[model samples]
Target chain A: MASSSEPSALPTLLVFRVRELRFLAALRERYRVLDFFTSGSPLAAFLAAAAGGADPPRALVTVGGDSVRVDAALLDAVPSLRFVHSTGAGLDHIDLGECARRGVGVASSGTVYSTDVADHAVGLLVDVLRRVSAADRFVRRGLWPLHGDYPLGSKLGGKRVGIIGLGNIGTLIAKRLAAFGCVICYSSRKPKESVSYWYFPSVHDLASESDVLVVACALTRETRHIVNKDVLAALGKDGVVVNIGRGPNIDEAELVAALKEGRIAGASLDVFDKEPKVPAELFSMDNVVLTHHVAVFTTESRSDLRDVTISNLEAFFAGRPLLNPVLHS
Target chain B: MASSSEPSALPTLLVFRVRELRFLAALRERYRVLDFFTSGSPLAAFLAAAAGGADPPRALVTVGGDSVRVDAALLDAVPSLRFVHSTGAGLDHIDLGECARRGVGVASSGTVYSTDVADHAVGLLVDVLRRVSAADRFVRRGLWPLHGDYPLGSKLGGKRVGIIGLGNIGTLIAKRLAAFGCVICYSSRKPKESVSYWYFPSVHDLASESDVLVVACALTRETRHIVNKDVLAALGKDGVVVNIGRGPNIDEAELVAALKEGRIAGASLDVFDKEPKVPAELFSMDNVVLTHHVAVFTTESRSDLRDVTISNLEAFFAGRPLLNPVLHS
Candidate 1:
């Protein structure tokens, strides 16, 4: 850590780009944020200048979902980097193994987006069960008068909801749905103690018992295509699925096929295997409710993320333990 | 009351039309439902036949939102009718005062739809605040790739939610939202003791202090158009309005203008001033969500309504009090 003797001169922070200027200004109060993307110079020239600076940046700040790949090659360019801070909960874009090997500390915006994501999950579930978006479309196209009464939707009360990954976001989803009188069960890497919710060891088992299957687990090698054909089949023809986690958490092709064949009653998806490119088949299906990957993009959550990122940076520079450190692999 | 000498013969139930045959079948086990619309004979002939029958229909069963107007003229035609059973909530089409004057007992599907409507209210609120329906439209139009990020939405937690009525449905909505960490306030005809939620005497004052205003009151002469221009103005530009109550409870014209002028952030309306008719202005606005008055039409709720209606009829015929009597003036 830098000595306290020169308290007036703030530490340098290397950033690729920032979405919010206010957040940048907040960070600038405590650090000299060197933004490579915003600086009016060639990329090679900026990197060369940054490499040759008198005080090399020791901390790198990044926003999640920016497709910012922080691998060994990028780390090699910034040899002085000792800490990586992500302004979002997702660590998919960050090379955690590389950071662990390099002895770099990692801090994430822990649980800041959890509530928003959980709320969106519940919203999507309710939309699917209540046919909110479909009914909206029916009303928008002036179909209500043409078609007398809109079809009856299913109720959320008494539904058996199976949540995949009973983590921070999933736990909150369970809590909110419980208040709506939904029966909650979950499948996770391991059964958590002290939690009274029923637990299933496998995703298929959980799906077979649930009227609604919610995917809220993080995307990983083992969890890829976690909700595949078998899980969808188990969920049955009357079951619905809601995905708020990473897109690849469920097999997009399988999900599309299941919905098309009426193997599943409906689906409400916020993420796709390849985002920004959803299957065209889902567009016309009234049973499906589709949204962009925005389960966490809320104003309040973004501000909370900004504060968390800044706090992590302050703690690192102040020689204190990071508030939310990602453990080494 | 008829003696139970003929055990196989069912009590006669008068009806105009039945939307759900399942509900009709459920009621058929207990009562002989006389169908006027489906009888293949003219209405006048059916009524004349029924009036001349030895066992004239003594109870009238109706479905809510069917706009089945039961007026004094209709009641006078069936002089033997002693009970009017609504298979759904909302007695808007039925003249309660006339029924009271005629000494006709009224039984509604009381509290059977309370949970479903409450769930829908919260669903609409979440959809509005999070822009779920709008985001779905954006994704369906294949704009996610063209537009890198959808706009951020507001969080439900920490927002002040004001309910128009603290009755069964409204109170359930408060309980569900309270679990989401929202602060709850309410406005009703009278403040009940032993309740802890903050109470506002008037809806205008409630709107002034709330971030989200939910219309959950019943439709009555005094409650009609309760949320007018002043209430909309008090809700302000950032406030959202979610109406799961009757449509006339709000001024639809003022609501449309307020939304057009950005007087309020957004609205999610399940009921309209006119059934099957919505303002064309709301069709293009992404800030609003419109549904076809389906807050209480869930399959589970409908089944519950059938049970409640049957129970009420059975109780009335067995010389006991109606299960859910709507006390009249």
Candidate 2:
């Protein structure tokens, strides 16, 4: 929506596959809008819509659907695109090199979901460490073991936390866990200059050392299955694994096997390789906690995210710097 | 239990109930111990054991049992009693008037379970507020909603927390939740001499004004069922209830009806009126997160509690004052 006093010189925005529709709708006055509804195949339809228009939109915003290959086609269709905003946090889509070579700026929602993801990480940590989810089930089932003369439970404080990919969300998680009195350490490609956490140069060293290993890094060719069989074996019997970044970072099959064999204590996952297709084995296990990919959908965050996206778009159209520009790999 | 160099004046404990038995057995040293073996009349068995002893110890310790009311019988049996220690935090079980009148010093475990109970409160808050158990079960049962869309969850930050009692565990919970950026208000019989918190003179006033109502007060004649139907109703539809103190504080049937009819959002409970006898109606509900009163059984707290209890016993036997002396109620 444009301000009445200052008529928006905003270029039209062709937002396709926007999961947060209400957020974008609030920005209608600020830009000449064209929302095309397409679930997985927005490329063909988006081209048709752009061609029929009087002038193509200077920018396009879409969610990550089919890998970065799909984004290559999107870049070709919108040649006049000066800026492309990926609605997702991880830029696993949107071929960064294609945009970089074309001088087309790309922006992603970076720190918008940091707080929510951090909260989810802590929730998962406590859920597994405290065995809260199991206790929740036990009480409802009339099977409270502690009350039945068997008391066994643990706390999360004074434990070592190993974070993979000490990015925005990881740092936020470190801060929150620090408040709970956990010893924080991390293993990144390279140590972050800002944090003074104990840095292990490799994932294996981190897995062996940490009492809890949290995956909060980007999903990439290098990171895929970084927490595989060897890593799980390295984590040993008393370690917990919490993943919020992506599913492929930890091999699910290996994780299930590790859990079954007591190679690792437990895991709490928010992101699965296949959405809504978690294994039944994990369902029956006491050591696993799974939440659907709804970490970023808090009521407050939903509204704030929409506003942040609109502000990013406004800056781009007004020749101002974008808030979270996507860096090409 | 005493070391070779230390005096052997420590009390010989006689525990009658399961919780007390577990707590007493955890002591590092072996004091002359007598374990009661009776189902219906544990206190009678405890009295029988105390009477049969050849000589009285320096002190007698009891946890939760009918043994508290049998104090006169115990003092009659053991005329050498200089002190009595209760394993449980509260001293309601001990006949404090008789102890004071008889010149017997009484001690209770103070604040040992504070962090454990507080951690459980935070876990329960997150579990119910985020609807974790419900979401967890949904995914496990292969009943993930077709659209992967469910009820939205709320953030703990910016919410108002009303503490019913501001004693040891309550203060700890306040400090912990404050880290999450919540507004903490409390209601106590006699408000502390110095504390920075919004105070409510009555439970209804606290219920009406807060988003979350937590009951952490001791179960007493005045506090029993204090959070009755009126208090629950005062909390209204969006309020969440968490009880780590005792179940009788809430009228169970009223809480069930309120939750069933959406008069309140949800609740998380640790203690129940009947041990191992949760209501069948609450079994299928996702709004409630139930635990078996094991919040104080964390690994760190358990070890710490043992060390503190033994130290207190040692101190008392060494002609030193009790660390956490229990005053007559």
Q: Which numbered prediction scores highest in DockQ against the true structure?
A: 1
Per-residue lDDT for B163-263 in model 2, tens only? 99999889888877776667999999977767798999899999999999999998888898888899999999999999988777788889988988999
Locate the minimum summed-lDDT window of 10 residues in model 1 chain A.
A1-10
- Spell out the clash pairs found in candidate 1: none
Query: What's model 1's overall lDDT?
Result: 0.86
Compute the lDDT of residue B197 as modeled in candidate 1. 92
The complex in candidate 2 yields a DockQ of: 0.49
Best candidate (score: TM-score): 1
**lDDT of candidate 2 over A1-329, digit per residue (tens):** 11222344666777766655566667565676666653233557656566456667787776653333425666676677778887676777666777888888888876777777777777788777787888877777666634454445677678899999898889888987776678999999898889889999999999889999999998888999989999888889989999988878889999999998988889988888776678778988987888877666577777667877887787788788888877421
Each candidate structure's TM-score, on Cα atoms with residue i matched to residue i, is 0.92, 0.86
Recovery fraction of native interface contacts for candidate 2: 0.55
- Give lDDT tens digits, candidate 1, residues B127-244: 9999999998998888888965567899999999999999999999998999899999999998968579999999999999999999999899999999999999999999999999
